[model samples]
Structure formats: structure tokens, C-alpha cells
Target: MTTTTENRHALPTGYQLQDYRLISIIGHGGFGITYLAKDTKLNHEVAIKEYFPNDLAIRENDHNVHPKSHQDKENFAWGLERFLQEGQTLATFQHPNIVRVLRYFEAHNTAYIVMEYEQGQSLSSAIKNKGTATEAFLLEIVSPLLEGLQAVHEAGLLHRDIKPDNIYLRDKDHSPVLLDFGAARYAIGSRSRSVTTIVTPGYTPFEQYQTKGDQGPWTDIYALGAVLYRIISDKIPVEAPKRVNAIKLREEADPLPPATKIGRKHYSERLLRNIDWALEIAEKDRPQTVSQWAEALLPPPSPTEQAKPVKPVNRITPATTSAATTRCGSTTAT
Candidate 1:
């Protein structure tokens, strides 16, 4: 799928950056432009990620990148360093579900990261075509995706952006490959300092839009829940901000029911409950680890296992809270 639309600002084809020749634009976003390029030296096609920073820089007629103004230069430089850091961090990831960034370099007054370009469609498009994803398909995609994400978190980095659109399903084995690093979003959000919002509406948790929201693995978990919700229901969840508003309102009606609630015939209760658990507006109410959430998606503990649990107690939610509206489970307006 075409990752981005509107030829807003992209380097023309044949443009050279080191040994890479720009073939075409693969994706474009506020912080960067991903291009399909040919590595003339290697004789291979690669995805070159350039630090475009649409909000901070622009392309001049001289074919070089420049900050929009003197004011943006500092922020632009900071974001550039972070982009390089993102490339360096991702270059070390050797997981199958993670996209590989082969190499990165600086040129044209900006940075570029060369990644292996997968010839496949994005999860978003796959969902659009299928209308609704099956439980088996959802598990097949999410479980391994979580493993990739676990690697990312262990590296001390966060992929603040984890929406369906950023997930590419490789054509070879239909395996999910995560695209886009959260470093860019964090950089942009840091620069704007509350003036600009750098988030996907439905996928971003309410706390994410806030610079001070207690973000962690759970933040990504919420977005993961939203993505699965979309895949199964084929509908966007209520945007985070609006959901927050409804929560505060208490009587304005919640947006949509949990996945199991809306997708009874389409999904199992265990799957839906886990999705709901991840989507708790409160960070304290969701799973704190991939393993914690994964357990919910699987069959509950066996009777003997429950009787003599070997694992440390992991509360799916605050114990004081019940599974009702006044408690943790009920998100009324269902």
C-alpha cells in the first residue's frame, strides 16, 4: 500500500544520497519521509528514511533540507539526533517481526536510515479488504507482534506509535513487521511543547497526548487494544480525547463496547476481555507487561494451577476495583 498520500514534499526520483538513488516515496509523515531507493553500490533496493520534519524543515531548490526558520533549528537538530538514535537502536534488533535498518548516515543537512523494504501490504489495508479479521488471524498477528514489541521495550526504547497503519504484513509469510519508531513522535512532541499534537487519534491513549501521562508498556498496550478492536470490529474506537471526556462526564455515553461485547459471534470472551483490559483509560488498570496481557488472551489458569500458582501474582487490574462500571470493567455507553 502507498504509505502516505499527497505529494506534499518528497525528493524527486533519481535524487542521489550517498550510494542510494531515490526510486520513489514509500511513506511520508510529520517527522520523516521514507523513500524506496536503490543502493547503487549494493545493487539492492532499500527503504531510506530521511529526517524531513515537515513541521520544522523544508526542502530548498538546492536539494538540501533546511529548518523553516532560525527558531526551529535547535528543535530540528535535536530531532535529527534522536532519529539517528532510533536508527542505531533499530539496527541492533535482530527479530523477524522488526524491520531491519541496514545502515544510517547524514547528508543534505539531514539524516537518512536505510531499511529493508518489505514487498507487502500494511495491516490497515489487509483489514480493509477482509472487513473483519478472525480470532485465529488476530492471535496469529498479535502474539508475534507483541514479541517484537517486547524486544523493543527491553532495549530501553518505546514505540509510542503502534497503530495498524504502522504495521506491515510481509508477503513472504504474512508475518507482521513493525514500522515507525516512537522516537520521532516524542521528538516532535517535545519540540512543540504542548502546542502541537503528534498522535494517531483512535490508537493513541488519552495519557499519550499529555506530555505528563504516565507512559510505559501499558501505553502501547492501549494502542494495541485499539488496533485489535479495529481489526475485529472494522471500526475505529472513540478517540482518546473524546473517551476521556465521556469518562469525566460519566453520563455522556461511552463510545463502543469491549471487543467481546460488540464481537460476540466474531470474537471470544477471553480475547474481548483482554482487549478491554488493555484499553482501560487508567494506566494502573491495564496489564503492565506483554506476558500479563498475553495471559488474558489465553485460556485461564487450570484448576490445579490456580490452586497452587507458581508465578508471582499479577493483578490484571486494581484489586479494589470490580469488573463493573463503578469498577474497572464497565465502560458504559456500550
Candidate 2:
């Protein structure tokens, strides 16, 4: 979905689902609807995602979701299983930068994944409010997100979606939290073998356009690079398919301008270059891992600097030292 659209079939407010009581609809997409809910047992708010693929299912007067047609029954069942699996996988993650999944369960002939409700605005909204985010601002958000993404990769999963809209900046500290994972969406699309449901235009890498394309950490790197591109240039990068066509014609014909040329004056060369490197059209050409990409953004150690043995510096205060001295100087003989 280009934007979160209204779902008329969403569970009504105050409706009970296991321990969660629906408070309001958070968002809806092709595959599901997320709701802001209250956990009655815990007496806390949480986000709950309900499986309701619009294409294959419908909600009846009784509020139970069922396959729209007999033909969709198998696909819906398969997708539901994958959705449950997605919830299970997410529940295992404990990273601060990734949304925390509390629990998941089946109800009303469907499934729901309950997650911690975060207080923040989306990166897209943040970008829209503050035009062309500063490099320092973007780094503070991106660095921690990369660590979270790296953790996802290590767990043998891919985000598939990494646009600005999917990133949330916590209101408390403006720290980025990766949200709305596309695992179930991708899994459903794979089961149905539909490519249209997979790509997110400018943020999607060219490999995802193919039916059997090789996807890995680099796929997410491209999307993250595109997000940074939007923040720096105030425009989304050209669609990956279009970029692929341009590259086929000639290197100079590539439509997406290099970040180095776009933001060099305002941002550090290393930062811009790292963005450009991640945005490389070919998977093999981009940095293979988050560490590989982040290291380039750091200033290299000086040539004259040599490795020294580790040392511990004193962190005591003079006032505390004087107080200790006074205490040791004299004592009452009790």
C-alpha cells in the first residue's frame, strides 16, 4: 500500500481479542490491519496486527474473517500460517531498535500479533516536517537502525521493506525503531507467486523485480540507501527497474544522481560516499554487510598514531578525593 488506507472491516473499538481490547485502528494494508489496543491483564497499550488479506478474505456480520471464495481458501490458509510464523519469529527479537513483539494468537478464525506500542512519528513524517535532514540527524537515526537490521539478517530473515514510512523515531530520544516488517507480505506473495505485491517502487532494489532474484542483506541496503537519498535530496531515487534500464543503455544514462554530487557541500564526503556505495545498482558492487558499510563512514586512524597498551584513566573527582582524605585524617574514638 502506498499509504495506510482505511479498513471498514477492522474490529470495532472495545472488541476483545484474548487479553487485548481494541482501542483504535493504527493502519491497514493489503495483508493486514494493525490496531492500537489495551492489554487488560497487563493494563498497558500495545499494537496488534490482524491477518486480513483483502484480496483473499472478507469479514462477515459476525466479525469472523473468511476466504472470499473457495479458490482463495488454500492460499488464505497458507498465508495465515506464514503470518503466524512471522509473529513467532518477531517475538524472538529483543533489540531496542526493532519493535518488540509481546505475543501472538489465533482468534475469530484469523491470527493476531501483539507488539509494544511505540510513541513516535514515522521517518516520513519527520522528513516532511523538517526538510532535508542534517547528516548528523540522519546518522543518529540510521546508525542504530543498521545495528537492528544486522540483527535481523543474522537471524536468517529479511525486512524486504525499509522505506522511511517503515521507520519510527521514538519521541523520547528520537531514536529510530524499525517497524512493519514485510516478512508475511513477502511470504504470502511468494505463495501466490505475485511480484506486484512485493516492490515499493523507488525503495525496492532491482533484484526484487525478478521472480527468482537472489535477495540478501544487500537488498535491504539498497532500500536504506534510497531512504537516505530521500532525506538528503528531498526526492526518492528513480525506480530500480528504470535504473536497470538506464544502466543497460549506458552508465551515464543512469537516472539516479550520485549522493556525493548532491550533498557533498553540506555533508561529509565519507557519508555521501557510503550512501552512494549502498545504492550501487548491482548487488555484488554494494557493501556486503552493515559493518562493511558503516566502517567507511568512520575517519581512518592517523598514520602517526600507533597501537598502545590498554590503560585505565582515573575518573574520581577532586571533591570526593578531599572528602576521603579528611575522613582518613581524623576519626572520633567511639
Candidate 3:
């Protein structure tokens, strides 16, 4: 339940980032802060993400980014490059479910990526307002999300941070759009392995906490699975650190309780199993791809739908046939 929550450190309403005028603070997190701004030239709204790693850097009164100390210079520069790279990479994405990256630029002694201002509430807000959603409704939201994530994977990118708050349910038709790529998060991983930047307790997989944690498409898949679990159960999955400690203390016990046990009344067995598979403590046990995880959501054919089983009538076992032959040989005909 305890996840990282960022505070407001946005520029004043009239302040400008190039041609975009800052309107209000939209989102703030460990890695960066986003703002609702108007592109004066284009006359449209855009979300601008500023590369400000709160742990290592701070925004000065003059709106210039500076590291906390001389010690953080290398890490800050490295992260800024990674942030710019993320923008460049995200700009290439054209999927409807993936939030389009409008443009990226350097200013205020750091970098910023411009994005479309989506008119919708986050999945987290929607769930809080609507309570537990039905399985069908969950599938409708999860399917497009996985497809979009698959596109991200194909492009050799990993959405390291994926939580309910990061997914937006658009107003137009309730479409899901993924937000926030951990721009400065990657470099900070190796820069100082001891330090923690962003931690979305329940949604974040165990491997992500480690600096050398082996991650792949499965990493994002694990998060997506958690999102599905949260939507249907209306409960945050147990945090990874707590789960780890509990698991170690009781080797025989399941650290993360099965979703089926918690959401049996609301969800089908098949649906719960898929969620559990993704929440598996071991990475190898989880679905390696988004499609692999989503495939099991659909239940298999029921017994009635399958071919009917035929009962044996004239069939006999070896022993029974031998006894019948012996009786015939003894002339015990009836």
C-alpha cells in the first residue's frame, strides 16, 4: 500500500519551457515531474516531462537543474542522456495504447519530453471510484494494454514502472493508455545500487529492486499481471519485500496469496490462475511474454463442450477373456 508519492515542484503558471506555457502540475514522481502546458505555437495542450531525479538533483530558484553535490555530477549527466534517449525511443511509438511522445528538448539545465495531454483519469482513480470491476470489463482493459506492451517489447524497450496510476483510462471510449517511462530510473540503477528511486510497492516486481536483477519482457508482464489483479480484486497485491521476508521465514508457505482465494466470488478460476502465474516469486515461473500471460485468461472448453466419453460395453480385460476361454474349453456351455 505504501508506494512512492511525489510532491509538487512545478513552475508558476506563466513560466515557459520554450514555446510551451506551464499551466499546472499534472504528475510528479521519483524520476521526473510532468506538467500540463499549452504549446503557444500549436495552440494545443501537451504534457512535458522534466528530467529531475529528486534523489540526486534539484531544481534551483532560476528553474535550472543542478545536482545535490559534486559527487552526483556523473550520475546526473548519465541519467539526463538516458532520459533524452527514452524520449527519442518513445517518440517512435505510434500505437494507440502507448502515449505518443510529441517531442523532446533540452532546457533549464536538463531535458524534457513533450507528450499529448490525455483527457482521462488514471486506472487507480477509476478503480477507487468504481470499486472492483467485472472480469469482462477487466479483459477489455487488459487486452489492449498487453498489445501495447508487446509493441514496446518488440521495439527493445521495457516499461520498468507499470502500475495502476501509470495506466490511464481515456474518456472518449474508456481506452487504456500507458504512461511514464522510467527515464532517469535506468542509470540510477547502476549509478548507486544502494539508493532507491521509485518504488511502487505492490505493483513493482521483486527483481526490479535489485541493481543487477535479470529483467526482460517478463518484467513488464509481471506488472501488467499485478494491474489485472488489482482491478478485479480491488486490493493492492502484497509488496515484494514483505513477500520475500515472509517466504523465507516459511519456506512451505506461499508468500503472495493466490488471487483465486481472494477474488473467487468475483473472478473465474482460470482468470485468477493467470494472475497468480504472473505474480509468481520466481521470474522463470512467470509468463515470459505478454501474450503468454493473456492467453490463459480464456478458459478451456468445458467437459460438455468437449467430445463425450463412451462407456465400454463388449470390451473385456486379459484376465476376464482367459477365464471365459477356460470355461469354454471345459465344456461348461450355458
Query: Among these predicted structures, which one has the highest lDDT?
Result: 2
Tens digit of per-residue lDDT, candidate 1, span 13-103 = 8888889898888777677888988889989889988888887888888878999988889888888889899999999999888899899
Per-residue alpha-carbon lDDT of candidate 3 for residues 1-334, written as tens digits (9 for 90 to 100): 1112335455666687899998777777677888888999999988888888888887778978899988788888989999999999999989888999999999988999999986776777666646556766776677678778878987889998898878876666677789887756867766777435655778878888887788898888888888888777667788877787777876657566789898898888888888888988778989887666655764443565345553232111111111111000111100
Off by over 4 Å in 1: 1-8, 194-196, 299-334
Q: RMSD to native for every prediction?
A: 8.3, 12.2, 17.7
lDDT of 1: 0.77
Question: Of models 1 and 3, which has the larger lDDT?
Answer: 1
Candidate 2 TM-score versus the reference: 0.86
Could you estimate the TM-score for every candidate?
0.86, 0.86, 0.84
In angstroms, give how far residue 238 of model 2 lies from its true place: 0.4
lDDT of 1 at 134: 63
* Model 3 regions lying over 4 Å from their true place: 1-8, 298-334
Candidate 2 residue lDDT tens string, 166-240: 887666667778888887778768777887887789899988888788899999998998899888898888998
